[model samples]
Structures are given as C-alpha cells and as structure tokens.
Target: MRTIVITGGTDGMGAALARHFLRAGDRIVVIGRSRAKFDALLATVTSDDRSAAARAEFLAADLSLVADSRRVVEHLQAKHAWIDALVLAASFIRQHRHITAEGREASWVLFFVSKYLFVTGLAAPLCAAERPVIVNTAVPGTRADAIDFDDLEMSEGFTFARSNAQQRRANELLGILAVTDNPDLAYVTWGPTRLVRSSFAGEVGKSMKIAAAVLGTLLGQRPDVAVRPIIGIVDAPTPGRAAYRGSKELALTVGDHDDEDAARLATAVEDQLR
Candidate 1:
C-alpha cells in the first residue's frame, strides 16, 4: 500500500483527509501534538476491526519549532525509505499575535515554517516514491502580502488577517521555489474558498466561535466538498501550481497571484530564513 504522511491528521481538515486516505487502503503516518486527539482518531479506526490499527501510525511533535520539525522528519527517515504523499494540514488561529519559542510568530511557524522544514527534510524519501506528491491546504482568496523585510512578525499591528496573509504568501513562495528546485516531487496547494466545519474554530473565544458557526452555515460548504481539491491533487498533482475549491484544470497558483511575484517572494523568504 502507498504510504501517506499527514500533519495535524488528528482533527479537522487533516483528520477528514486521513479518514478518506485510510479508507482507500493507504497506510497513514500522522504527526500531531495532541495525544487525546490522536487516541480518539485511533479509537475510530480500531473501533471498526482492531486490525485496522495496523494501517495507522502516529508521531507526536510540536511543529512550531524548526528544530523539532527536523527531528520529526529524522525520526521518520529512520523508519521509512519512501513516502508517496505528504499532506500538511496543521494550523491554528491565534487572535492576538503570539511568538513561538523559536522567536517566530505562532501562526507563521505552524502554517509555513514547519511545513517547509517537513517537506525539505523528507525530500529524499519523497523522491524515492513511485509518485510523490505534496498537498498543502491553503486558505482561498488569501491576500498574498509581500513580507515586510523590516517587520516580519508584524509586531507593529498584528491582526489574524494580516498574519494569515503573510503565512499564505510564504507558503505560496515556498511551493514555487520548491517545485522549481525539486522537480522530482510534485507540489499542489489545495485552496478552498470556505470550509463548512473547522476544528480550528473550536478553541477560540465565544464570539469568534459564533462567527465561525455563522460563516460555516452561511458561506461554507461541507468538509468533504471543501476538501475536494486536496483529494483531487493527491490523486493527481500538478508540479508547480495550486487548485481551488471548484474547477479541476482552472486553478490559480497562489490564488490569482503572479508567477514573477511568487519568485520574488521566494527570494525574500530565503533571505528571511538566512
């Protein structure tokens, strides 16, 4: 069976994706930070035939730190020589700006930094796979803000929208540069305009929670439908671009942004990493 590695596979979009892949007879190696959620997911798998547990494996890691991300991949490298796909669905929304232990913004670390580390670290095994693909869950219609070289963290004015925009742009640039640099592996970003349900909203304040609910009911689509792009891309990924919620071939790379801009943003990201 082909092996798929998923981050944040214990809940929300990640968990939904994992269930679908598992049903397809693929082995899943999930990386998560929550033991409770992991156990719950395992319970769901094992509840229907205990032997199904063999098809699933898990590793616990706090992906907010770059070092920890590398360590997680190193651990994986020790176990498996090849991996068919890597789906990064790990994310959380912090209303106020918070800095990670790595001195990076929490959302940036979760959404982009950890993903970059995971993808780069697992490059060798990915190349070894028969058909390796990288699927990233991106927020659709995200504003691709150019990273301010001076204030990368936006300590000046930190709103969820602005921070999320920064992270989304970083992810886009990373995909562009990575696909260009590593032609052996195909990368696809799945952008859904809105998702019907999100576990990410469960941990927020009551007001935000209400808003999340309203949005889900009003503007969102079912999780399965919202995740259609991810499923499609995993089955067949385009090397250097992304797909939105609707339409198969008609996709906007980085959500209708420019290729040259993605390249320039990649350069800026490289500089930031240095």
Candidate 2:
C-alpha cells in the first residue's frame, strides 16, 4: 500500500482527497490545526475497524509556523521510511493581513515557507521510493505583476489582491524548482477550474466575506470534484509538469517575464529557507 502525507487534511480539498484515498486502501497521514476536525476525519475512516480500506492517522499543527512545519516533517519521516505522495493542499487566504510568531505573514508562511520546507525535508524519503508524487494545490490568481522580493512579508503594503498574485506566482516558481532539484521525483501543481469553498476566511473583511459566501453559494465546486485534478496529477506520466484537470496544456501562463521572475523567486525561497 502507498503512504501519503496530506497537510490540512481535515477540511476542504485536503479532507476530500484523504477520504478518497483511504477508501482506495492507501495509508494516509493527515496534518491539520483542529483536534475536532482531525478526530472527526479519523473516526470516519475507522468507523468500521473490520474494513480493509480504512487506514489513517493525524497530527495537529498550526502550519503558519515554520518551526511547526519542521517538526511535522520530522514526525512523519520518523514514523515512515518512504512517502508515496505528498499533497500540499492546505492554504491560507485572507482579506486582512496576519503574521505568525516567526515574523512572517500568515499567507506567505502557509503558501511559501511551510510548503517549501515540507517538500525539502521530505524529498529524500520521497526519492527513496520507487515512484513518488508531489502534488501542490494552487489557484489561478492575479499574475500581471511580479513578486516583491524586498517586501515579501507585505510589511510595506498588504492587499488581498497583491498577496494572491504573489502566492500563485510562488507556486509556479516552486514547481519549477522542484522539477530542477529532484528529477527523480514527480511534482505537479494542481489548478482547479472552480473555487474551493473553505472556512479559511473567518477573519476576513466583512465585504470580502460576503463575496466569498455568495461565490461559494453560486459557483463553488464540491471539494471532492475540485480535488480530482490532484488524483490525476499523481497518476500522470513521468517528467513532472503542471496540470489542469481535464485540460490539455500543463503550463500556467504567467507573463512575458515569468521565466526570469521564477528564477529570482526560487533563489529568494532558497535563501529564506536557509
């Protein structure tokens, strides 16, 4: 049986994927923040102890902290020798800015710091496996501008739109780096065609919250449907590429300067993580 580690696996897209894989007989290790959500997900899987398909475990963590992220990887690696799949579906989206105790913006930390470290820490074990997949959950966001190298933390100016743009761009950059650094491991960043309805915006502005609620009501896809791309991504052919579920091309059209920007962004990420 394959072993998979999915962050934020207690809710939304992550939870949906976890449930799907559990039923498929894969061993899952879920990481999240809420003990209640974690317990609920575990209970669902282990409801019938006699069922062969149900097998899973969980670790509670606030992923916004890099130290927590390091601890999480250590915990997982210590428990398992190899991981068949690593899903980065847990994300941070917000209207107002929030910072972690590490002095980094929560959105940036979740989207960049934690994600980068988790992959780096797990790369060795993933490579040790016969075939391993790294699926990163990303959304198509505002990509007209480049990421701010000097003020990545958004200390100077933090706007919801700007942060979204930076995070999406960061995903592509990370994907490129993953392909370059670990050629033996397959990596894909999944971009869903529709929005995922998550309770991540509880602290968002009133207007933005209303907008999310309305959009969620009108156009959101079930987390299970949205996460289908993730399953497809993991099953895709070797020589890892970005994938859009039920779509043709694997590229995310950023801009004319995306190549240069991606290189710079990768360097920045490496430096920051170091």
Candidate 3:
C-alpha cells in the first residue's frame, strides 16, 4: 500500500507504469497536460474496479510552468502527506525550440525545470515513505555534455538533439544530487533500450520523426518490457544506482561515457538549480 505519483501519466511509459502499479494495489495519482486523456484513463481505471475510484486520482496541467509544478505539488500534498515513489516520465522533445509563456525554453522547462521543482517541492512528503524512491527516466543520449550556463534554457542556440541530450545529462546529475543531499532517499536514473511508442514522441519534427521511426522499428522494445526493470528498481530492498535492460540490470553507466564529464554535468546542474 504505497502511494505512487507519476507525471505524464496519461500516456506512454507513464500510463503503462500507472496500470502496472494499480494492478499491484498501489495508490496512484497521475498528472498530465490533457484533461481528455486524464478523464479517459480515469474512466478505464474505474471501470476495471470501482475501488480504483478511491485509489486513483488525476490532475491536468502543463508542467512547463514552474507555477503549475508548484500547484501540482501543493494539490497532491494536500491529499496525502507521504508518497512512496515519484516517477518523472514526462519529457519534452520537439524538433524546433518552443518557448513557454514563462520566458523559458519549453523543452528545457519540461525536462529540467518542472522535474527539479517537483522533486524539491515534494521532498518532505516523499521522504516520509518507509523507503522512498525517486526515478527519473533518462537515455544514453545524455552522453557527457556540458551545460551552457550563459544560455541555461538554450534560447540562443537550440536544437532538438542538443536540448534532449542536455536534459538527459541533467537527469543523471539530479539523481546523484538527490541521493547525496538526502541520504534517506534512493535515486535511480535509467534508460530502457527500446523506444516507448507513445503520443509523447508524436510531437517530434518530420525529420526527427523519420529517424525515430527508423530507430524504433529497428530497435524498439515493447513498453511493458522496457518498464519492467524500472518497477523492479522501485521495489528493490535498497536503491542507489540501478540500470536495466528487459528486467535485468545492465551497465549503462559503464564505459558508455566519461565519468569526469558526468561529474561536471552534475555540478553544473546543482549550480543552475541553486
């Protein structure tokens, strides 16, 4: 009987995770940007079992806004004092850079800003869990990239590849920092080998879409297969850094990129968040 909170829960990895967790009898709260999708998922969950009505709740907001992230934290905290797990599966992947109304790059806001606020804002509640876990979904694309401190939002020279890479890098650093700053909390930043076929990725530009399609067709694994290991990581007796491939732990952090680069990226992220 744990409370699990997932962003971007209306679809894709988030949705799949919600279903799996619900079936396992964990209370879940899902936040998404679409009311229709939220309602639709709620309807299905309720239909499966009326008890799901009591166990599950849905909220809709564009997380690109810091205010919205704050509101989400407040709303959920008001409902429950403790959260067993916080999974940030929401992502921003666009071919062209889009600016949020808040004057920050939309993709960066989604990947970095919203994620940071959610984790920091909910730290107390999440820490209340017997064994709390914070999981940030990331990819190998993060590599060993350097953060552009001068243009933190990538407003000056933005590209889909660079923006996505930076966010993935940020995810890794956040995991390390979260673990280091709060010794009681367990953190894991992992990437599945398969591309999750989700509406979230539908917003990619044409060329990128073609590239994704090709990669997905060639190397994509089913969503369930990709997410099973994450569930295991969440349920592990103790968590620090766990990587997985098809429910088996793999060495994604080993030799894929340089340790120095990852450390520098983590430091930059800490400074930017400060």
lDDT of each: 0.74, 0.76, 0.74
- Pick by lDDT: which candidate is best? 2
TM-score quality measure for candidate 3: 0.85
Number of colliding residue pairs in each model: 0, 0, 0
Q: Which candidate would rank higher by TM-score, 2 or 3?
A: 2
Those runs of model 2 whose alpha carbons end farther than 4 Å from true positions after fitting are: 48-54, 140-145, 245-250, 254-263
Global Cα lDDT for candidate 3: 0.74
Kindly list the per-residue Cα lDDT of model 3 for residues 1-274, writing each as its tens digit: 8999999888888888888888788999898887787677767767777787678878888888877887998897787889999998886577788877876677887888788778777878887888999877866334544456457778677887777777876666666656665677877776776676665453676777787777777877767667887788778736565544445555544434455544565565456555
Q: Write the per-residue lDDT of candidate 1 for residues 154-225, one digit (tens) a residue.
A: 778878778777776677666776666668677766666655576753245789888888887888777666
Name the best candidate (by TM-score): 2
Off by over 4 Å in 3: 211-219, 245-274
Q: Write the per-residue lDDT of candidate 2 for residues 1-274, one digit (tens) a residue.
A: 8888999898988888888888778888888888788777666767755363346788888888888998998987788898888999776567779977887788988877788888878877787767788887765434637479877878988987788778877776776667676787777666677666766534677777788889987898888887776777665536665555434345565577766776787678777767
Worst 10-residue lDDT window for candidate 2 reads 241-250
Clashing pairs in 3: none
Candidate 2 CA-lDDT value:
0.76
